[model samples]
Target: LLLLGLMRDEDTSDPEPLDRSGVDDDRLRLVFTCCHPALGLDARVALTLRVVGGLEVPEVARALLTTESTMYQRLVRAKRKITAARIPYRVPAADELPDRVHGVLHVIHLVYTEGHVASSGDDLLRVDLCREAIRLARLVADLMPADAEALGLLAHLLLTDARRAARTDARGRPVALEDQDRGRWDRDAVVEGTAILEHALGLGPPGPFQVQAAIAALHAEAPHWDATDWPQIAALYGELARIAPSPVVTVNRAAALAMADGPHVGLALLAGLEADERIDRYQPFHATRAELLARSGDSDGAAAAYRRAIELTGNAAEREALTERSRRALGR
Candidate 1:
């Protein structure tokens, strides 16, 4: 028989040669592979951003809102785990695509979320993280053209990013969506995102991402806050709640209800969520509650809620914004 032992040794010993010209493809592969289901979600996201997104350890730490030392240790552990487990650095095969794709999507979404709202940084938005996320999302959508959710996610991120210009004032204070100057929005991103959303919606049944993109599209198309289709947005949020059913989604739904119906209706909805221990410390919940209370003429209660929100968040910019809101509430 042939020297089968020697052949096996060669196969095991030699690593595949790197293709330098295909750096972007390699990065994409690294992200998808690193975000494998076998790894912890947190580790997967950190490693993917660190390695594939080519973000420095400190930048990754900032995006994740953790210390650099902790992030470095986490990255070291992830690489060690990958090597020990012999996790391949290639994309998943067709049979294993679904689970791997979901993991990758989840990691990308997390990255985008951090970029959209820096969890602990002084800056209200991390443009670099947002750009990285959008780039990765576009790559994923291009690679999986048939994946409706991928397209929807890409569209959703683009639509959100399109508003980056108007998200804050010249003084770096956060601007409410209604108060943002529509003229400052990115028309190119709006066009592309709307087109992608339409394509995604055409491909399959409306998933949570698609629904979210549709809602964003509505906001993008509206000329002014008063022109927004609140009833349609409320309906979409209702559908998203049914499909996704998260506390965050419920909060958003409550906001939409407040817009569509009245402040009292939203306040009633939020009253049920106030006792939920899981989200009691979540800043958005308190902020939304403050808004609803303010709209309902409960200035004292709104001020208290705003103060609680300001206390819960670590981002200095976010704290400043909330403090301003609290001051306004107290003054009212």
Candidate 2:
């Protein structure tokens, strides 16, 4: 009878373990291994999310905006590469650490970015994904106490996340940063992020992450929207553009220029981007153009630009917000 009961219990037992407390070390090890320099950056991101972040194949694929089959093949290939190359499941040696660590940081940043603004989803923010990224980032920061970029990345995430409560209205419409309620901002996150940014800046000359963190810090420190250091923010954007040189950065700089100099100046900068085939269809480009046009008293032009932006974006929340902006622009 005892043997019979034991067999029945074994048959009914769960195949997977219920407790995951012991998996943290394994997760960290997998992340470090997946981020090995031997793998491509895309592969590193895919593998790390799959093995370390504990994301399912379909979820990772959705975040990457790729098909499940494609993502599955990518994960399989990454695993094969790891095995065939004999990449050790451990942190890199001190001599080989810096280069490898950058890839890991990039993966973590990508994860956080997807969470902060999902590639394709109904919800504007995926709280679970964002929290997971923060958890992994914290682990990375803990593991590399002296890495400025890691700390800066964490600081940036924290500072950005501090505004989560005020990012949307009661009805779930997106709220512009300038209009968000400062009282709702996470004070503890702001304080921690500021300390982290200061520590990172003290480490050495600022890298791209450090520079971005500085920008976030300035925003967080501002008492009010009008009191924000627009000149300093624009200066930081200039520095970021010099270092990064992406179309997105250019658009951001244009927005800052509108705040610092004037809407006309910002519109002129955006005009060049609008004509560029590479970013002409980019949603943010049109959205920024809409705002700058509205600020310049071109109501009709602003309405048209907002319509174009609405057409380009897929996020329902962003679309609804753009529609509202379009309505306001048209005085309807």
Candidate 3:
């Protein structure tokens, strides 16, 4: 995670005059324009990559595997709409910060998710996006240093990215955490993230992002997957679910439960989630379902769930891993 690139540069223009209160108006305008609610989620993400990352049009096209012309058109349209909406560039007022911050966090999540489980292109991991997102998050934290949500978000990304070196194999295949070579983990990043989490805790009460960061910190401290404090992780996930209850969160929490209690317990928890229409199309739900079923000795059901997960998402790495799991479950 390289948030080091947000430093002020000679190429960047000087700050403009602030609004009535004398805060830098140009900076505030950039934030509002970058995270404008009117922009579609995908559009917002793309625009942020271009503007914040200072990526060349061709570089973005290469990263996303799209043509330069197409990316140019998209950016042009996005700029016009932001200008039309007259969104400001600075951080939102206290009353509006929550919604604005959520937009920024969502963009970071989207970028890291793409890196963790790339949706297209030949590579499974897009380290560039992950690093870029971390860089952007650092900028956000700098802009709102006192904001616990922003700091927690940065910490979460840092800790998660710290495990990147161990997430896959030499051939780019998926490596389950239990089987990963911990020696390859980025210890420096882990230490940095833990420090950031501590700083975030000192800021204010814990939020969903802080809870998630705590879970990541736990993982970072473990010497091996089996050494992971599953019970603590489960509790953290519980807190996250309470603060930001989503079917996906519950599904992930179930995985920790399976590790903490038993496969049967996790199976029971997941049973109630089958009707969670909010994440019906989400890949992790079926992936978790398959894992629980396999651990519960329902090989047939596990295989079916794995197959369904593969069909639901086009992320090559995840799809490949799902297919492999399905084959193993069926003893093929």
Against the true structure, whose lDDT is highest?
1
Candidates, ranked, TM-score = 1, 2, 3
Choose 1 or 3, whichever is better by lDDT.
1
- Clashing residue pairs, backbone N/CA/C < 3 A, model 3: 3-135, 27-89, 28-89, 28-90, 29-88, 29-89, 29-90, 30-89, 31-89
What TM-score against the true fold does each predicted structure earn? 0.83, 0.80, 0.77
lDDT of 3 by residue, 96-205 (tens): 65667767876666566666666655566788878867876787787678888889999999999988988887878778888888888888988988999999999888
List candidate 2 segments past 4 Å from native. 1-27, 42-95, 274-277
Across residues 234-265, which tens digit of lDDT does each residue of candidate 1 receive?
Answer: 99999999998877888899999999999998
Q: Candidate 1 regions off by >4 Å? A: 1-23, 40-81, 93-96
Top TM-score prediction, candidate number: 1
Model 3: residues >4 Å from true position, as ranges? 1-31, 37-84, 89-99
Candidate 3 local lDDT, residue 142: 76
Error of 1 at 7 (Å): 24
Query: What TM-score number comes out for model 2?
Result: 0.80
Report lDDT per candidate.
Answer: 0.80, 0.78, 0.74
